[model samples]
Target: MPALAVFTATAATGTMRPTIATAVAIVLAATSGIAVLWSTRVGAGVGPDRAALGVLAVACAMGAVASGVQAARIHTLAAHPLTELTGGRTGVQLLVTGFDRPIRSGGVMVPVRVEVTGSGTSARAAQLDVVLLARDGWRGLPPGTRVETSVAVLEPRSAGDPPALRALTAPRVTGLPGWTGRAPAAVRERLRQVSGRALKGEAVGLLPSFVLGDEGRIASETREEFRAAGLSHLAAVSGANTTYVVGAVLLAAAAVRVGRRGRIVVAGLALAGFVAVVGPEPAVLRAAGTGAIGLAALGAHRTGRPLAALAAVVLLIALLDPTTATGAGFVLSVSATAALVLVARPVAQRIRRPWMPGPVADALAVCIVAHVATLPVLVASGLGSGPWALPANIAVAPAVPLVTVLGTSAAALGPVWESGAVVLAAACSPALWWLDTVAGVVAGLPGSPAVTPG
Candidate 1:
């Protein structure tokens, strides 16, 4: 476990390097793990063998280091010559990959991931972080759209800034999104239509965000309210959302009298569709992993170790893409998931009273555990203290499952059968109102939930 601390500490803070040091360290880690496994007799303990645990920990450490290095390599901007473009303007072509969240202070800054193909002598292939000043041509472009522009490039002002180059001039999109990109773009447009037709007021803007993770249409005031209520995570498609989707599918299967195996099959199909619709982004993949592991545990009728499951996910993900180690979102996700697995059950038992329903107790436990577990991370990330979060979460806990299940059903049926989608949306409206009400009340309190950074 001490070794795990060493590994995570190094992985979290260490810069990427492609050197003999990394190779040697990885080799040593592998050998140490293998040697431990070999010396300790198989089936040595009634529970898990200590040797196996040691090996797993060591392997995870190596995986973390290797992933970090790989991510550093992909971030070529880390090594780009800032001196070359610091004082002068250059005509650079950028393929828009994704947009970052606009800041809360009413400014339109889109952090875009792009492949740079500069003009003239500067022409070269490299992926760079570019901040697009959202204006006439830059705003509302879906991921995979290509924008080419010429402007001055500036150095990052802060360590936490996402883009390496900030364009001083407006961008003109040179190319439209590819066919593959068109699917997501079309789906988003459909979502906008459905929301506008089925819901009203703030719900119209927030529904797509709640179900599809599209915050492009949310009002700034609504965003602030959600942030203050500590309900901001609902906008993101996470494990909780995945869990609801699978649960809804399973319920449908059961209603049809499907056998256990058939239900599993249905759940799998649903998971695949969900992933496709959500896009195979890192967070979505993580959510999928969490959901799959949860399903596996339930199917086996065994309670697997949550910590081990989390570790395995970290190792596998890091090996696939190292840059995840550096993402604050990833860190928060892992921590919150771990807390759910490790602490939620025990807290549920402790808080359960004779009068309280078991489901209510469990929901409250999860809300409290997740809030407490993520508090340090939130604080470190400058989210500050959200004193009213617990009550707000508890109030809306029941509505989450309803909103997810009914809303997903509506979205699925919307394109197929308009009448059916409307029916489902009608069912979902009450839950949406409940959630919105809770957020509105909690956010209206005297002080901001976000604490001032000292």
Candidate 2:
């Protein structure tokens, strides 16, 4: 379902590549349905009797019909005028959707849902992608805050351009004007307190990001180091990060002899709290949903169906917020988790070599599976296309669990134990240094692809 959303979003953008991809997915889905029916009938020693054939035919037809309906919905949503007003001068009133931390461009860009409220007043509702340029005063708007702005809407520009076009596109926003908003004062105060507490040291800074998904306090140099080392995912409230937190909590509960039912209840509460702390962003929600399904499967002693859980999460999230069908992060998060669950074990089993130790073999397998799963996306997004990514991931994978666990503990306890935070910070410094070195080395390798416009 998430893949379908991505295809739909790409198709809506009128990009030929995405359109072709969507068509191919539809064809493959149809073929798979027929293949399933054929295999079942042939393998069961039952001839394709009239009733069985009829049932199979109806099932295949329903599958095709469902796919068609979803495709049509995507096409219609993409064709909406709001998605197309990219490269021109226009006035719009936009409801601020979300704000990302400032990138290297020196200003933050925000996503807003715009409705035409100016002279071309047809009273039509369309989602215009608007970006507010944050120079000085505009740097303070938080996610979930509404900003009303007047600005020029430009077309999507390539990443190589000088002052890359800050215009709005289907999924991301580019350029616009100044914004005005009366933000919630209490939220501002809370943020201020959190930020103030976090600036005391490296541990405090890392803690805020771990606990609240607030990376604003982390030093620019530290942030760059993590990015260079490919450990930046630890900073985000992703599935791995959440899993570590929940696992720690469950372990502590079990150590105290908590009953199975009690463990489930505690884990559920922790999951809810973790979600709230991370903010209800699409990626976080997807991770939470995936984790919940995983826990349920474990409790029931079932060999969990990660793909089915992922599909269910995608459908539910898309139905709630159709726009998420377009976000790249959402796609990446779901894909990564699915890869971990479905492909890791099999790949690990196949890599048993005489020279490799058991632990080394396990790590290599996981890296291979995840990289293989994400290879298409990495290529499609124009990141490095080399197979070297898997080796790099294997080398760095062990450090991830350590960094995530300590980092989260530091963050959760920073408010109460400054000395403890100092110790965690000291322990994390070496890991951070190692991570930074790896990223810089890999990134500097010849042919390492960088981010490109889609």
Candidate 3:
């Protein structure tokens, strides 16, 4: 039963390679069941509970068989030639499978599953991943798009090495000879329209990336600054952005006298819209999963435990992509969410003064939560464990929601009303400037502690 629980939980989380782990789990379960059956048949005291145990043993055997079958399927899927493409080999075409945006990483990474047909041989691959560094003129090719590129295919080299870096040494292509073509016209048009309205001069190039995860125009220097300052999450399609957008939509609904149910409906729509806009990367999807769970809790009038929700989401995500079990972003995202849920409340309560306003308290809570959660990783990554992170976050937290909502709205409106977009962008400038300043100041502090052993 214990083995079964672990297997089931791991599978549901989508974080593990189902075939290998599930197979091992099933084998262990089968062995245990056989041992239990043999003991019951031999002359062990077979009481009523013992009989129940026998029945459970039989159930476990059946479950093992089922898991074995599933494992076989996963093995077959993993064995496909196309999916196996790794190791910096050249000359292949693949279909863009998936992507992610980690806060600590400077750019988006894309994973492709290729169907290679060469020398009259055809093969299919599943989720052959790659990293697409955000470049000045780079645009994302949508999923199912067949891009024919001469990429170096590589394989997973070591446990300690980063997956993105490993992927670069060996790469594969999907949909070659027949480029899968660009993203849908509607999506492109919407992006262009949004970009045109929300951006001007220096900011114009960053609009696509900010709005849709298309990081073609953002300058390299700006990207570096964001990473060095620990503010790179702002550029990613993370839960922070999603939550802010959803919250804004809910607030607007409330202002117009929308009831609870109505507000939920609006929130759901906005969440969906945000996902669409951001292109459904894995990290964003995880964030969305947690956000949805949070909304459900709100709707039920229950105390929404963000940590529990994050755990549930992590479990699910891990089951789906077991490889991500090793990804730093996965660890960081879960930690950040846990921090917000578990630590923020207590910290805020402790620090709340009689003179503190409701808004200030809320802002402080947000900072405390995110800062506490991310501290271990920040330190471990050699980015410095500045005790001042909390204060800096507190100072910046208040403006995050403002920047997300107004900036997104401005970008969306930029194409429709350039003038309105300009106004909204102007309104957002102060917050962006302040955020940049805080990051710069905190990052510059001397003798910050490193979480990892030097």
Candidate 4:
């Protein structure tokens, strides 16, 4: 709906700030107002489209208000009592809630969240978020690990970022992740080792990232190359990854002559397992939700109106979690999906000629339109998108699908059959090589990372 887009824009632009009750009142008032206007419009020039837009606009406003409330709540939470003490050390027991992949700055920086359990002098418990900066020893800790330590509470780096605390000494590990978290961690580790062995050189580092969304082993140079070329999103798993996974499952089910309902059931289960393994990152979560909506449309035998389905999903998610309206990634995702739905097919048909096959035309059209669609969001977010993005994507486009299919197969087979996993990984080496070459060449071009201000 036009209102959905307008309200989403309003939210993204950071204009509205209503309380929870005010948001509710607005929704009710808007709904009644639209109904009255639509009914009384029989003698006027007002149309159904305009009425529908009014309804959708109210829905979006409601979402924006809710998101503001959520943001305020989070900010208040970050003002924890532990964070108020500046330059003070306190003995606290922490139960690890989440762990970010460690990165090396001046020293190794490990970002994590923990629930502080008071010990020794204090007995209060509170949830705290901080980044641990050290040269080593942080890599061993996983989610659910308990570590006892003393730390100096400091101010947050910026207004939006999480609060900061410094750990001077290595925390004593008291607990490790139980089976819930251990399974995914173990699987990721084995897949990394297997990918390294099967693919040589850069492919070893890049393949796992393409498949499993793990870029820890990739070289800094290569990682920068990807960012410059605007291909970094491919390395981070997203909706496309989920779609390919579910599509593969559906195809296999079809080959076995499975019933429609049975195929849907199998695909749903596969999608859930994939998300769990991938660790529920924001992009992954959004992709999973979009994929689930698509699957539901298929099960209902109403797959023709994918544009409508995508809109519904976007509106619903925005209403439930309003902050998504302001995220560049989420905006890019919606824009990209919209381009595929509306522009890809027509562009494909126009470009299809005697020399090009239909599928090839479609693929090229998708790459071009997706880049074009997300340009505005990129410019707004200051992520340095440029002309290089289109060509780089076109150059390596064909290799991506192959890498995803084969890499996923390798990951699934690794725990069950090491030999099979290696074979699948070896099959993906050529695609990975091509991808690496494209990134290298494109990233080196002058004016590659053009940063246009919004």
Top-TM-score candidate index: 1
CA lDDT for candidate 2 = 0.54
Range of the 10 consecutive residues with the lowest summed lDDT in candidate 2: 158-167
- lDDT string, candidate 1, 231-251, tens digits: 988898887777778977887
Question: Which stretches in model 4 have alpha-carbon errors above 4 Å?
Answer: 1-57, 60-68, 71-75, 82-99, 102-111, 117-124, 128-135, 149-161, 164-167, 255-257, 280-283, 291-325, 450-454
For each candidate in turn, the TM-score is: 0.81, 0.67, 0.71, 0.79
Q: Tell how far residue 115 is off in model 2, in angstroms.
A: 4.9
lDDT of 4: 0.68
Please report, in order, the local distance difference test score of every candidate based on alpha carbons. Answer: 0.67, 0.54, 0.55, 0.68
Candidate 3, 1-454: lDDT as tens digits:
3333433534432323655547665675877577587656655555446656666665466445445544544564456453345443434455665433322244445565544522235433344444543322123445655655444444444421222322222232334322222322234345555455554543554444444555445556555454555565566556567767887788789999999889878888888766654555566676676656544433333345644565556654544555463365656666665555555556666788999986578557766677667777767865544556566666778877787787667655654666776677667656666766676666666643322211
Identify the leading candidate in terms of lDDT. Answer: 4
Badly placed stretches (over 4 Å) of model 1 are 1-77, 81-89, 99-101, 107-111, 129-133, 151-154, 157-162, 167-171, 294-301, 305-307, 349-358, 450-454
Q: Clashing residue pairs, candidate 1?
A: 67-322
Decoy 3 TM-score against native: 0.71
Scored against the true structure, residue 449 in model 1 reaches a CA lDDT of 68
- Model 4 lDDT tens row, 227-322: 788898888676667766787788799999999889979998889878766655455678886655544433343445876777776766665544
lDDT of 2 by residue, 49-78 (tens): 545655554444434434444454456445
TM-score, model 4 to reference:
0.79
